[model samples]
Target: IYLPYTGTTIGSFGYVPMEQMEGGKAYAASDLYSLGTTCFHLLTNVHPWDLWKKQGYRWVNSWRKHLKQPVSEQLWWIMDRLLPESYQHRYQSVDQVLEVLEFQSATPANPSQSTSKYHESFLNFLTSLRQNDQLKKQVMMGGVSLLSLGLITQGYGYFRYQTFPSNLSFLIAGLPSSTYLKTTLNGHTNSVRSIAVSPDSQYLVSGSNDHTVKIWDLPKGELVRTLNGHDGNVYSVAITPDGETIASGGDDNTIKIWNLKTGELKNNLTGHQGFISSVAISSDGKTLVSGSYDHTIKVWDLPTGKLKQTLTGETNWVSSVVISPDGKTLVSGNGGNTIRIWDLDTGNLKKTLTGHRDSVVSLIISPDGKTLFSSSLDRNIKIWDLTIGELKNTLTGHIYYVHSLAISPDGKTLVSGSANNTIKVWNVETGELKNTLTGHTNWVSSLAISPDGKTLVSGSRDDSIKLWKLP
Candidate 1:
């Protein structure tokens, strides 16, 4: 099927697919081609644009030759299907690529000499790219697509927005804002409060004030099923480390766990006397943590739904909770504009981080477990060194309350959703504002970054979830 577009060549050169360049028509596969190009550039440290002027699409055919070291033939095969010059030869759907990804990446040709040996990127086909600092920086490369013009750039936010006279004024400024968006999921009748993506990045789970948790299939952004159980507005949702279970907290003052595949209610844990605001699972998949307006954090055995410990002494209600990747430390953002560091193994408060001027609503840690990022009603994102309990950097730009934060798999980029109806992209290490994305009509309540760092999902108060193709 063909989707008509203007004849102008608006994107950075080589990343544009053949269909977009030849006939002014594009399809879903065009983005696949663009993704493949990004993968290739990550594998070979060569910008696709550098080859576009001379070799054109021909360069994609022999991409492996530029690889500095060995890449499994299996990986090369997947790229073969992705980087093909024609849509017919490419993977017809993103689901198709996801289906075969695991089988092709079971083992590398040379385990010792892996992606890092060739390039610094943690771009693995099936494996968690944060293989070891794999996600140390967010989306390893800035990705672009000419087809949708939605994903302008990745690692650095400079290219994300259709800027004013300072940047590309000729094309994007003349186009509608809808031109910057590819997918918007509308199902929840109330504001979407929080969202999470599966570890594999195939499914999205959103908790809404509509008293429902919705699971959506990726790429297609189609509603897979609607989960109903919470008695009040659903406030937070978290997919387990294994992605087989989903834990949801809400105004109901309860935590409900559901089967990821069957949508069955597996268990409901009741204890909190106040509204449950956040839920988090440890990396080991054995521990569950919840934060509530009851002014306490509860630790439970995830498999049994049995309560293990109740942490108190909080000056304000708990709003958000997150565990380090190592499963040893627990961090909670509290209503008193403070963050409490707890020892998960001992259930003791390790330290208190006080910096925000308002309630801290969101928390996310770098994959390596060395850093912690927190956002608050203060309209700021605070970066802290997790080991020493010291503040590192404070990122400020959001005009309103920062409601959510997500770090790309590369751990390089940090994306924050705000009540101002915008998503701001940041350079995690430098605390610099990369770019601001505008589309949501209401507050951007929640945000999630896919494991591969290719997609960014934002849930809004407008009662819609938008799937963004990362740059």
Candidate 2:
């Protein structure tokens, strides 16, 4: 039995301590020891093997000194019981650990009472672990039953007294609310063309025809800063996954990168001859892809702003660009009513997907990078199989041209903004229209989903941005 880290695997058994490996027999206490090591590593920001090589079990005794937060005596006692070098001295059963945790919960040992920041940070770390599919599968297969229970208890203890955003409740699998408009942000002097949200969900950036980019405090809908650098109408905007940089493309035929926190210009990329229309950053945040009226897509080195590759096979103006999560494939929608898939490593065309009767206006790849969603001026949204390059389904609900599309973080729901002044939410797998959001009085030009999958932001030609509480 073992506790898997980010890069650990079952085949990598040499990582086990020498004493545990020599026995060739795993006990319940062995599992507890491994979990305790994992907890110590996470708390101290050091690898277990490094500490074991230097100081053996003595590393556990000094772990508290390395922690960023103060640990309570009850918690320290629990940790001590789990890290004993002798199996007889360690925890013998899952029930024993739970009993300790339950008793600790009743006392003032709760981390939230003394160090709320530490508890919040630890909660975020556990939430990320739960979201990791590979780690979850490995733990289930390894049969580490107690670790699962411990994670659940920790989650409950942290979240029980904390208040989350109202829309967060709707992110649950079966909990659907009556969708409603939450607030309207009115700062763009002209039609808002594009929008992007930071990965932390704390800030929103919007590009407008007024030739400026505005950053807003997401929850409060208050304007934070106005960026005025573009000489032409800003057409597209994107935020890096790290939430440190902002990229925008405009009719000035240039791509500008800015420091998101400081609002300072970082780099200016120039190559496109026509108006830039769409921009997307790879999941790794190393590559930036942009599409323009020049009928081409250009890939750039994000840090240096140097051109890496230019794709120029499209016959019409490129309207949308998206990169697969793996950063191996690039997908672009063109005014020629087609979608093209390119191999990022080789800069070669892989396939052309054709189904829309009119120009393809927006494109988004599913979270798993298996399905491609495209919206078109044909008034329809087409779902395509990324592996086989075939159309799987077509959703027809919008009365006018569909302008933009966004998928939830879980890839379970899709929202499309249309020229008919309405936004439609659909079940991605079933192609069923779940709800129709009607608030924008003019054409909805852009759409973005928050990283938490709870809030949906839409920008319109009506010169306003609306935040929708998703169901």
Candidate 3:
């Protein structure tokens, strides 16, 4: 038995068992449970607390699906035995587990060896048969005879199918090539300034310079509805994490929230004194942040549409704003070529990073919240270390201003839309250009990657949205 004292500090409470949570005595099985939880966390990159909150130990199924490599059934059984909620059901002694492992290890070599031998003998027989001329000729004649019969049968079936309707199977194989233009969505009458895909990837939303926000069915590229509330050119749009609400900001100096499902106006938040340039929603969908030409950032309560806090210190127009995945930090790009990191809870400026030679037009943080990518009017994108506030690397290839940027869900690929009428894809790890996509007749205004990372969507100033199939 083990007793956890009052002052004992655990590195991660997620690894602790339920008995420890109740501040009661624990047995050796509790320690085994903690060990198993640690193993799961290390293997699947998921926390035990999150798993418990979501579905208790049933999260093992989810973790197993996410494994990078397969594990033996014996190993899975052992892990499951260790994670039982009841101590009485878990392995009572370490010696018992070791004995089971030892027995498994000692019992498994001969079957695979015998299977390998059988396969080798079968292959040798086929080779020998191929080398024998007489046998080969006989086999070829037999195969030809069978094929002729099959062709005759297939012809009969084809004629029969012509008279009676039936379904047929067509073997179409091969994935999409490296990068190809999939389709062009045409509805926005003016320049499409911003684009966002819903969390489920079923709907796409676009804000255009024609003073309209349009929603389209993602799979068919058909216009679903047109929202006509913004009185001026709509510049920025964001979908809530839940995919139920959309927040859009534009030249009207107001942020409008719309019901994503019904396309009805939910609320109109007004506070900015100038044109709103960018808008972003927290990962939890509880807070909405907007940046405007008034040189201020406003954080609002998403549920009630009430102003929560206002942050003002930038000297020029605030062009872009993005929240970290953890929902604790906010990064903003301003027209003065500076990036500011702010404490989301306190609304205080934490650090100011400077490197761009011209206006910072776009900002995006990595999915891990460790690195930040920013695009500038200087025709370059800079990678920054968010923790230490240092410039890590600079990517240069665009001949004109870089207007928009997006990162893949896996954080391996970074895509940028530029004023040069091209989209560039880069390897995030090595800062190498992977591919340059060209189709837009004018500047590329916005870019977004679908949740599956297999589709890249670009909205260009040519008044069109193009979808690209990614490798």
Candidate 4:
């Protein structure tokens, strides 16, 4: 689709912003103007070239004059942003444009349908305009119904019908992926720092900055018990494979064990001088690992609460730690931009994998124990071949720090929780991002997958836990 430019100009006529016509530069906003013009032409039968010949840049200001029929305020606002004469006034990126589209086309017909709901009250604006039957027919005849009022009606059945109007589907498909949001569990007084799902998939334990560990009935989303013993914020939580005991580590530099069924404080282990950042229980539920701001990875006996060994050499904070499913390896991520592989029992550091330029925020091993995924403050998720101890691939999509990583039990899908307040579902084999699920208003701090791999649980700085169906 190359356009024949007369001299210093490119891009198709009226769709081009004034800055580009003057041989300045083209930006994302310039492309947005083109999209807006296309949507306008589709809705009103008014060609952009004819308008460019008549009013030039001033045409956008009086765009409504050519409209024979009216459009909903939500649709009007979306078109208004896309058709701004100045690039500075247009939507800066495609995400911003689609964000508006999703918000405007939102449906509250069911909880699952509105899980992707951003701001519903946005449609309350621009309703004073008269309704247009012709415009609705024009959109219906054309598959691209950006101005479809049926989307705004009581039915709002895109999900109900299990289909979407063609061109609008393309836009929605690329934006935040539609997901079935199960429920939001809120109880923490502060940031919910970490979360873990029981092996039986019946319970979920969450650690929070509120200095408490709360257990919830997973199926019902009901708060079961809140264990309060940590003097400071509970930074990490890990449940045993048997689902009998839970270990919680916190800012108070203590790891407390509790009965998952009875909510009894079993033992409190203390050794590290700094705040605990992460805790992991092995698949066998025999060994427990803790990484801390104290710059060391401590291995402890899960049943007896005795300090086994402290693997040291890190000059910075140990941000996260995890045990392999086979129960033979220990991986620790630190603020020093390196991942440490250690012999779980010997406390010997085997290899220090380096690729991330910033702090490694989280680490997770594949179920098969063949691959390791590490997230970092560099905004990259690196996949490593544990056997070779080398980088396999780097997944780059998150705009902010990749805070946490979780993998389904089958090891085919990987999900990353980001500081951008969104969770990205990725295909492990191809490294392709399958979906970008957004709802949380703050940083997504931690993620856990149910044993059956059907549900995903996320803990966020918004002080809420969101359960989402695997897309």
Query: How close is every model to the real structure, measured as TM-score?
Result: 0.63, 0.63, 0.63, 0.64
Alpha-carbon deviation at 281 in model 1, angstroms: 0.6
Local accuracy of candidate 3 as per-residue lDDT tens digits, 1-471 = 122334343435566666566655455556566656766665567778886786654454235555565543334445655675545445554434434433333333444433443333433434444456675444333322321232223322222222211111111113322348888999988889999999888889999988999999888889999999998779999999889999999988999999999999999999899779999999999999999888899999999999999998998778899999999999999877899999999999999999997779899999899999999866799999998899999998775569999999999999998765678888999998877887786779899998877688999877899988864
Which wins on lDDT, candidate 1 or candidate 2? Answer: 2
Cα RMSD, each candidate: 22.2, 24.8, 26.8, 17.1
lDDT of 4 at 17: 67
lDDT of each residue in 1-471, candidate 4, tens digit only = 113233435556766667667764666556556667776675678988898897666567456567766544345445656785546446665545444445334423345434423223323311211145555334323322233233333223332233211223221223444445889999997789899999999999999988899999999999999999998779899999999999999878899999999999999999998778899999999899999887888899888888889888987788899998888889998877889998887878899999997778899999899999999867799999998899999998775568888999999999999765788889999999888888886779999999988789999977899998987
**RMSD of candidate 3 to true structure, Å:** 26.8
Pairs with steric clashes in candidate 2: none
- Candidate 1 lowest-lDDT run of ten: 156-165
- Predicted structure 3: clash tally: 0
Q: How many backbone clashes does candidate 2 have?
A: 0
Residue 63 of model 1 has an lDDT of: 73
Candidate 1 accuracy as lDDT: 0.75
Q: What residue runs in model 1 are displaced by over 4 Å at the alpha carbon?
A: 1-180
lDDT of 4 at 182: 85
lDDT of 1 by residue, 207-303 (tens): 9988999999986889999999988779999988788999999977899999999999999999999778899999889999999877899999999
TM-score of 2: 0.63
